[model samples]
Target chain A: MTTSTFSERGAAAVGSAAAAAVGDGARHLIEKRAAAVDAYPAMDAMRDRVREIRLHTLAHLDAYLADFADSVEAAGGHVFFAADADEANAYILGVAGEAGAELVVKSKSMVTEEIELNGALEAGGLTIVETDLGEFIVQLSGDRPSHIVAPVLHWTKEQVGHLFADQLGVPYADEPTELNQIARTHLRRIFLRADMGISGVNFAAASTGTIAIVTNEGNGRLTTTAPRVHVAVMGMERVVPTVEDLGVMLEVLGRSATGQSLTTYTNLITGPRRPDDDDGPDEFHVVIVDNGRTAVLGDEVSEVLACIRCGACLNICPVYRTVGGHAYGDVYPGPVGSVLSPILFGFEGREELPYACTLCGACLEVCPARIDLPSLLVNLRERVAQEGTAFSWLDRPLDAYEFAATHPTMWTASIDGASLAGRANRGGWFKRLPWRGKTWTSVRNLPAPAVTSFRRWWKKHHGA
Target chain B: MAAHTVSVLDATEGPIVVPSGSCAAMMIDHYADLLSDDDALAAAARRVAGRVREFTQFVVDDLGLDGLEADATGPITFHPSCHGLRHLGLRGYGERVLDHVGVERRPLEAAEECCGFGGLFAVEMPEISGALMETKIGHVEATGAETLVGYDMSCLMHLAGGMRRRGTDVEVRHIAEIIAGEDEA
Candidate 1:
């Protein structure tokens, strides 16, 4: 197929999948999510539980992660701690090389995405297939995930219908069930013929060394069981102290994510095919990726690690609703993405991401784990400014303003000058403004500053 | 001193009187929190949950600003900053307020989103932050709105800097200031 044809088909497939995933009320998905979540009586209970679990886990992350590694090793699985994406990808590719793997079937793993694993594996001449329905659509489209939980949320149904017909050799159909069935059929064959299974861990239990994978479809289970070797890629933050904490997290994950009581499938795989087991993989490996998360730990923004990938912030975000995830232009999106993307990718390409929020605090309000999203976004923005990344033109004036505000003499003189100008422009607002202030008046009216500045009014009233 | 007895009006449909914009935003956000209690709070919360309109919404809906005034003859554009657009869901509320005040509402390109002030976000991510604000200023300049009105003061302040740096003729005012007819010199 031509490159353009492929892109068109991919775009169409993703659009249809998103429509299916989002269901109806596409115009007002955020409002609908608010209403649906508002009506759910169990949401509050789940949020409380999830908050407690995350707090406890983050407090003892080091101990739990070490124990998890120990348990996995004891269960006949090897654990690798990769400090960054390059190291993680190199290690995974090295493993694939050792195994002499050619064809790999994978489940949805954001950690792998973070490391850009497919590119590395593909470079090694390995044919990789993404089995998860959403991941499959993204792979076919060659698009990055717009959401944490729902990857293809940007597309409409008609788009997906067109994609499936062109790429999968199926007739155009937008109905969710038909499209899902089509994907399932295509990926089933890939799973049965795969040499290795790669998946992301939702929660790693330290007590039992079990990796939990939650999904609505049964793709995750198949990806693990059908392949001879199962490789689980996880961020270091994915571990919980025990299965009890995992249970609480799972409860919150389902409710806060999609308002479901439970995901259709929740698989806990402890190791490869056991000696007496009827069906499972023969070899198991766990890759723990630090990827800037260690730097985030012990910081004021460490509270971000508590995220369970629920995508609650995406559903409720006003900005995301309008521009969608691509506007942020990162692997993550919405309120959480605004804070995390800059920290991970550095503030170069994603400088606009932090400023995209209204600081309305909606993300913090709905976060099941109670992450202080607005504060973190603010903190990250401050860091970016302090690093002198802000445009010089704006920065100089802001610095000058800050300096003047801190100095009583300069501040008073400036206020007096502004007040005089306000009086001169009184009875009619200034059609033109001075300096960068013109940017504001250029679009809307500058209320000609107050004829009497607020400071002046306060001084008169309070005898300052 | 006049005792301003602003009635803490309870929306029989949403929630009770919520004073602050952030607090009202919070109410719509944590609607579940408002409903987790007894029937009284639940009913009250539901009534005010989605019903907590912004100051602009109240002005346009209750005061009927459009009916009171004819056409406002001036170059007027609006900035729908984060609080008004994202938190308060007041996309066109400012226009409705301005239209009622008899002001000429000029169409501004990319006027519906944030100006990147974001309270502390401007200080935090200053470069990207200023870049966003500059984008907003460019759109504002393109509109040639002699007056730029929004619901939040913080955004106006940030935009004020961009305007001053570029030496544009745009002015910034709060929606409340305009609606209360306090914009008159």
Candidate 2:
């Protein structure tokens, strides 16, 4: 769906969910987040440092990535580079096939979502179960994550209660404790029996040839440990220079992501289980996927690669808060998604995602990486304007507006034209109009053109 | 029109004040970059950009808070459009304009948030826009003020539309009009 339709649907959905704990959750998020950032008075400095580190790393990404790959190799792990989604999926499937893996447990990896891994694995007749509670719920409902950080922000207790009852054959319960316990029971069976596991890398450290995964749940550990074959997918840009750099990134990541000092789980894995190690996969593989990331690295929006996937931009974004995440129609959502998705996937159908924001600059202030999301959105808007994808309808009206706005005579005439049109109309508003303005009148009435334009009134009475 | 506006700005080097914050912000922040490929136009745009000012800012800068004489009765609140609040970093100039006009000021909750007009965005995402407007209007209603005031007329327009649709008696006015004391009636 286009942004309009998505927003239209989202509005109805949010309105209904307001009395159903969504409001409480939003309130908690607001207060906790305020406290989180406010407690760290030097949050801006931390953000700046992280951004600088990311910028420097992205500039030398090839070297860091190569170093990371070699490090992984030295640590007794294999690395595969996939240029596209299909390649990434095929490579993972090939690894799963070699391991003779059937049931594969997955932690919440948006990279997997980006590559549509579950579908690919399903087609290959492999069962993939999402081990993260929220992902499991989303998987059960066959629904997309509506918020990047809180996947089921769109799902209320009542909805989840119903979903669990219907899908998990559990006794219906709306309480958080009951719901979580129910999920824990179901996901544990999959965790133990799964032959392979897949996860997303949050930060890959070139210094140690290590990958760190941050999660609030133990599922990440369970998913990484239980399977004999472990596969991790990472976008090429999510690498840091050193373990110390990873430490700094972590300090900001949890704080910025969910206002936590640290996530419950921050596991730094080097390779499969060593002989001394009690339990881990004998074979470990890291699938480094470009999938249009390298293209985004050199462009005007390369700063988007500075994103830490902390979802701070998403949490602070008003557009994401209102329309939710699905409106973006991309793996990533909110401010970062607006910039990154268009650059990664091209802006054919999803042009409105960039324009979806009011250019509020809220995302910029709260971002750990300090990626100037609004600026990048504007750049994307210009690119979409050039492509004439979703902006073609805007071309003529914008052209006419440009003509009228810049030409003093035309500008002067247009005011009078508006005055005349105001008089010609019902002396109030066009309740509903056709053509370009069709949507404006859908929810709110547009005031009829003024009887006298401000410029005209200023010029005439004030002698401008 | 672009050429003419550029020329006009060139001709009148000062005093190009606009009531709409977004209008001023576009020229001030975006015009040169928008016209970057055309050297002359871009240069001209830079000339125009440097001189433009938002209305409330202009009012405060030129006249100070003591310029106006009209005393507005009861409670009044100034709504800060996102363009003014976030984009241009406008803080209290609009309210200062209202104060200059002798209007009683009431603090609005969520004052710096966008009213969701967003030019065509209000139309394109009417549902979300309307939702935000509802939240804003709820704040306005919470203020229990007879008048809703703002620097941008588009914000007023959206608020007014919501008020009308909701059958509320609240009045929305531009800071310029309020400063002129035109709403004393």
Candidate 3:
């Protein structure tokens, strides 16, 4: 079994070498994003438009889903509503079986990652290849994706060189151009030989039955068209009402994800190959995976559904930059994951994930969807506090604190008593502390309380 | 607890001056939500929240003070605590005060980033918190400023602790403390 990244040993390994790389990468993305937003005068207005469209679609999701399904079917494509991962995987597997597919190529899809679709297909005795360059490296090395946009961000080029040489039996090349060429040469063969392709839907337009797949490497286009059978797995919340709404979302998504005015390829697939079309999939199937999104929609954090998977939150999250993504131990990492994970996947085992944030509000500022991430984190913390499961140690101490705070005498006396104690210590600093406070003193010395309590000073000076 | 705080704040006749930026944020941003179940209490919380102001914010905006002329120790860099900077919109209050004083203010790189002193978070997840603190301190060191100042004491204490442990002699002070020009207590 893989060791938990939250384990003491696992956490200690983070924040040193990884901090530099991740911090630099995040800084680079943020700088570019700032420049892009600065250049586009209507960027903020477009963000508002995208947010309204998403919230509107979510409010009437049933109608939109029905409309999307009908439109897809009308255009000679099949749509299956999967209630959970099991149903989604089963439907996709059935499609592959009916098509007599042995090889499958997949584009970059976080929703597919959420469903663990690749493992399910591989388990069914089909060879699967990740066509996106970052995803391909992650697939070849058997490593989890460390970032949303840049999946293998934590992997250095030297490491990729080693991975390629060992896994692909090719000469080790550390330069980015050489590495890109190697991956392109390798994935080209898979694309030609693959019988089925699975891709993620970035934004599925309900009005026209069109699904937009945004990518910089053009791999999404290949994955959708190269194979005879194409399957698109989308989180149910990915749907928007109209093609115009899709365009508005696309505008923010590209600028927010990687600072590009527009990605190199934005493939809008309406249906399967028509008789008039030259090259496209012979058949098209869309698996709209609800998984836990509908449940989340009824909850307080329904606003998170408006997210277009831009990865802007991760790029600006200070904690994400410091500790890296695997520390989150979820399919989605960074700010969005912290709020969405515990709520979607029960908070029993991974309760600490929500508390991982500093509530810095950086994610809120950069989020293209304008999701209030810090407030959501605090909301989850309130839940954790009420449950008293994740932070059971704080329950009694907080109870005492609440009691003292409620009582004026106890509050004053405690402050005065702490002040007296502080006056006894030299340098007014405690290098070591007892019990639970040692976690703090273990890193930095704590300042002692003031020699005179503020209340006492006020009374002595003003006699009020 | 929120109800009790709201009642106390409601009884107050004057503007509520909060020395800590985070506490001011808790009142202004969260108190109403915390008491949302009771319409009267929620309204009272909002009233009190409107009156709440951080120390430097009160000094600059409410008092209409441009600057305080005082003898500062050395080259000073400011750290914008997250709550004061983002929640309360106290971004320029302290900086304007420092500028008025004619002190040498070195610009902090990534000044808006958090110092990782998130109350219980500092103790709960010290590994990650310490990592963030370390990165922030590294930025502080890069500025080569002798004194680091911010409006929030909690952030100052957290960064000061990390600076102490790292053996950086840089003094940590609240913006008010620097304005007051008080010696170390």
Candidate 4:
């Protein structure tokens, strides 16, 4: 069932057993991430260096973006700078039409999801297939991806088995190896017959004009090479100044993402099929998507673009663990999404995203790039308050609290009143409350104020 | 509010000890930045910031309150509140204080995970906040501890409210209240 609004979705997920499963998966990854970082002491230094590299690259993005475009052209590859999602999709459709592409296979690309590229392609009459196992399951099930690195982390084996039986008309099999074989058998045919390949760029090296695609499965290689035309979609911030910078980025990305020293395959595609190349796409295209990135770059939350899409923030975020990804109601979820979504998609109706977090700062702790997530979230909240969208309801109580806080007499009077109320409650605790306070009382009781104010006690004891 | 706080605190000669972890963090980590525009208040904020110490940190680290004695009902678990643990870099000041008291301390699972009492967070996003509290309480119960102690009163009250609602036997206590050897609760 589709839930409306983020709060409704959050309430639904938090109460379900799925929350537990998401928590377990997140914890498992967190363990691996921690162990991987601990095992390689150099990774700590690399983390600091990568953050510097990302910041430096972003600072000189204008110069580097031009250099990147020039390098791609020099390497015999076409580059398209898309100001938004529509432009990105329109250009891709133009390329596909020129190639007369009918079937398209995609390696996992969050940028494509951000742009809603798959739906646009299918609408443009191209049959699209997701080559990533997790993404394939998500597509077959008609469900949105729930995690960054592991999209199907929310799905159980039994659920996938049932989805396969219902969607793929396959025999029921829940065993891991059997499930892998079924998906492999089903996807292998699409890989060969696919006319166009679409993949996401993990890192776009500006100096060399090489786009790196890191994947555990070999689908990234096949998706980039098997088809007659290859297209790479990347967020413009994915660019790094030098190939050496790309190496440091890759090191931190692998350790923080899945706790692996490195992914099984890291494909660095420079250009399309060359004179000496045995295999590759004939036409290579790179779509550098802006899609609100420049706006974010200008904003105070620009440090968020430094993210490498490592889901460490998600795995370590207490809020994400409880509500899962779907509750975020956006393509990007977790701490990064909370800050990015509202800024990217206007904070008009999406004001709740920043408040959804508890400002735990756990995300910053685990973040490989060490983006200050709490500060960004608080900044968005300040904007939301200024916009007066959702937080208007809080104005009255806050005003009263502020009044009480500023005025010593009123503060003392309020304290005395609350102390009297507390004295009325049995054992100085309230089992339930009414009105706005019902939010807390709905799930938990509140501690009543003490019978005597600390000031009163101090004065009486000291006889002051 | 910060300016008012600084003005009031500037008159005091003693170190200003903040009992709440989040409050202490705000004073130490954010005050100077918030007041930087006013040169006088900025210097004063820094002075207050330097003197500010989390209650448990001050007791254990500054006062050198070692080898103390206290009493509690059964094994207890501690939930390190997020602000104190991360911002103030409170490394087991409360736990070390408790160690001196010689209470049987049971390890709380995922001790560093937030208790979800993020100021307005519990009231604004109740479902998510309650869900996190339930997860935290589950670990607290799993420790089989009769008492749960934490540095922040906000987190303790949140956990206590959830426990009261669930009819769980675990009691919540602030580390200060426990250190004071009070039977109130």
Candidate 5:
């Protein structure tokens, strides 16, 4: 089986050749996040309060789900519960059918990406375009988003220059201003003509049936207002009990996301366009998609669903900083991806994703909702290790180590054996290995297990 | 794991010290949970965990970096492992040791980052591990320091391994090894 994650192409992107660039990019983003937190000393207190709020909400999630749906219906908006991706896509397509929509403009929404909504609409013979600039860039490049907040951060502007020249047939422009102007000119035309707009809900308040969407660009506001029909797709967990809870979540969202005090736009849409409203969509629909989140609700690791999607975890994750997102082989990447993907999908194809991290707990530190990512990762690994297929080879050391650790006699012998092995290498390390340890030794040296066990030394000296 | 905890309980009394922070974290933070189902084992774990300390913490608190002699003279960089700084609350201890010992603790670029020796993770995702190591090592060289000290051995082991494979002369040692007056290169 393929044990290593570094395929030929992935090796080049995150390997030594580009490691510096990757590290710098990650450091830059995390520093911005840190500065925002540093600027607001009370961020930790706010983080805890919101975490408690989410903890309470998630505990009564079954009740709240019904409450939310009822409130949405009462506010003159339609609420559809979709159980899986196909179901969600089918429901949204049916809504498009009922509305007789020709073109759909989408604000940047990860859940829509999660359900592959654009493809479903396109297959049903409707044109769709992503209105977020970063989303627009990845769309044109035919690339899945490499990051949650900044989708195309993996590609340099020079590469985008080439992509635009080749794909858009526009004059190559490397400057941010020029490229933005070019995109604005192109998407602005589409925004005006779109019959339906689809957006992702950052947070939904159950009490008033208000949907909150955050954006750095004006596109989200325009997408909801200009289109005649508006459909918002949200992962089922993206709801809070009231508007006040949305305010506290918003406090952490922008600061944790891009270090902005608040995003350029935080659209709090209450129902569709009202009769008194001058400019807005006439029909509003909320698609609360389960897509496997309901299954995660009562599990031991259920707290993972409390994620605010601010992506603070990704910015500080060492594995994400090193390998980049595409290597994760999942919709979400980094520490959160490792936990969320295996649970949502299954443990079969994505077994290695949970093992991707060093379990550093960096993600937990920056998390706005305070998800204990490292603990969840270890628990996931423990579950994986429970499988017999895991013990065949890769985890042999882990299994052996567990046995040796518990068995004092065998552990002592192994220590003595390592002591003997250390004598052969004057440098005091094993330069190569005789077994599958080549996975480790091929790139670096293994310190010989301490020649004399610490217990043995303590007994010899201190008479324990 | 239960039997191991019993053995540890039989052997230790108070103030058990581990050289590596990751080991200390497992003992201090995880053992109780690992033995949670059994009340007796869980209580025993909590007792043992309360006494557990990383080497830096032991030296600074119990031994009190008050009178320790300064040993290493050259410029030194400190690699703060993820487990040590984040999990076990290990920061000021390393600085206190370096300060009292009169060693020059040069700040590392990305000093709080992981060196990517995640036990079995190095084997499972070797490319990502190696790439992270490359970034950390590049910063170590940029510091122009002759040696690197860390609170955890695993991180140093990974750094030392990468340095050996790359044939770089930068040396790696645990903070205990540094304070104990060992000259390694």
Candidate 6:
């Protein structure tokens, strides 16, 4: 299909599947964040603090990760560093096997999605239940996440009603509060009966050897606490040097992410449940997954790792606003998604994603982590086009333009030819033209060039 | 090396000629940059800067282009791009130029919003960038203007691609030829 038809159909699909997924997702996120805009003077102030914390932590990543692993091991817990997604999945499945974990309760975690961990575990004969409300909805519907922060953003309340009725054998309800209550009651059983809890860490403190999980729904708290063995998976980059840095980052993260002064619950897990702690997991396993991120860090575009998964860029993005996130056809959507997806998945399947923008600076303005989004997008496009990673057709025009740009004589000739042709067709404008120019004029009128080119005018007037 | 010197000419009453609106505004805001202590550099800067007036402002105020007999028939929407509005502060210059050419100026909604075609940005963040252009195209469609005229070619180029992709029927033109009454030529 043509880009227009594809986008039009894709937009309609996204619009219909969920009660205006983008709008509802935006409304939910905005309502939450608007409360904090007044609470935080400027997004920049919080952003700068977050940047410092992330930078400081990244600098000491190795040392902190080692310390965190040491702590988990000392407290009779297990720690594994998976070089890639497959390795991470294999390691998690092995742990499930050792513990004989049949039913696994999971909190919202992007790392698991990255590693495809749940599928691996399920393949290993474990029934994994996602406890987070948004994640549970997506899991039930067997749909991929539309938004990073709000996974089931593409699903409307009515869709949720259908999915719940079909999957959980529950009565259909359209009210958000009612659906949420139904999900809560159903998930509460999994939380109580699960043999293992799998969760993603927001930040890991190197100094105290602690894992931090920030959530609004409190499902993360339950998932981590209810099971006998809690398995925490995190990206290698998700570490902080000290507790102070964690405190600073948390302040910025919650405020910038959901616009909450603080997430309803911020759980810090240190080496499993303590000996005296009544209701906490006894065995803790911290899995550090480094799938392509280490390679990303080595590149100039490593700054993308600084993303906190706030989805602020997505929320404010005009492109994401109009066509929604699915058009990009990636796990992550919107501005940050465009840059990171190509790097993570390579450009072969996603060549169309880069060509879909006007480069407005809104995404850059709203990013709380202050990622140089526009520059990264440009860098990726150049990589895709010039490097011949994908979309080989783009090279022709680019090369032609490059050649014309370099050879001034040819450039001037082309301009003059264009001007002459334009003048000839100038009843008012050229409705169509030959070659690629026709591609442009096919949809809109091309202004016929002046009878004289600018260069010619300069020569005539200034006697160059 | 020759030492630079400055010469102040008596203000001329005729049209103040300028090459571009951005440079013209710079002359007004940073005129001090032109008047260096060195006389020759000062004269050269002033001479160059003096030619940087808004096409319409220059024509209406300096050249009397508006008084000339011109065919003003077509209804065109005026989009004062950021550089022209923010950098040059040539507010309403495009409108005045269009009016002079005898074209009816159709006002566009959210006309001031960036078209997301920042030179390198179009290729960079295509998704978000395209999203912004969608908003811009929506505004242009709302105007129902036959032709979308703006001062910047870069913005038009990006918008033209987007309009094509969306299969919209609106024409983009530079303000220069429109005001010069050169569209027919």
Candidate whose lDDT is highest: 4
- Per residue, candidate 2 scores C-alpha lDDT tens digits across A385-451 of 7777764666788888888887667887888888898978845877778976767776677788878
Model 5 C-alpha lDDT per residue in residues B1-185, reported as the tens digit of each score: 65486557747677887888888898888888888888888888888888888898888778876678756788888887878788987766787788778888787887777888887777766676787888899999999889887888777888888998888898887777776675322
User: Which residue runs of candidate 3 sit more than 4 Å off their true CA positions?
Assistant: A1-10, A16-19, B183-185
- TM-score of each candidate's B chain against the true B chain: 0.68, 0.91, 0.92, 0.94, 0.92, 0.69
User: Best candidate per DockQ, number?
Assistant: 4
**Deviating ranges (above 4 Å) for candidate 6:** A1-20, A27-35, A74-76, A347-356, A430-443, A456-464, B1-134, B140-151, B157-185
Output the lDDT of residue A164, model 6. Answer: 86
lDDT of 6 at A294: 72
What lDDT score belongs to each candidate, Candidate 1 first?
Answer: 0.71, 0.81, 0.87, 0.89, 0.82, 0.72
What's the lDDT for residue B68 in model 5? 83
When superposed on Cα atoms, how far off is each prediction in RMSD? 11.4, 3.0, 1.8, 1.8, 2.6, 8.3
Per-model DockQ against the true two-chain complex: 0.08, 0.55, 0.66, 0.68, 0.60, 0.14
Model 1 chain B weakest 10-residue run by lDDT: B1-10
Q: What is the interface root-mean-square deviation of candidate 5?
A: 3.1
Which digits, one per residue and each the tens of the lDDT, describe model 5 over residues A1-464?
13344233245566542344445566687888899999999999999988998999999987887888888888789999999999889988898899899989999999988888888889999999999998998788788886777777677777777887888789999998888888888899999999999999999998888999999888999999999999999999998999999999999999998888999999999888778899999899999999999899977789999999887788888888776777776668778888998898777766767777888888888998899989998888788877743434765666788898888789878887876666555447777887787878867877766655566666886797
Which parts of model 5 have CA positions greater than 4 angstroms off? A1-13, A16-23, A389-392, A448-464, B183-185
On residues B1-185, what C-alpha lDDT tens digit does candidate 2 reach at each position? Answer: 55566766777756788888988888888888877888988998998888788998887786466647654576788788877777788877777667666678888997876777777777667777787788888999898888888888777888888777777778887777665667311
Report the Cα lDDT for candidate 1. Answer: 0.71
- Using Cα atoms with residue i matched to residue i, what is each candidate's TM-score against the true structure? 0.69, 0.92, 0.97, 0.97, 0.94, 0.76
lDDT score for candidate 6 against the true structure: 0.72
Q: Rank the candidate models, highest DockQ first.
A: 4, 3, 5, 2, 6, 1
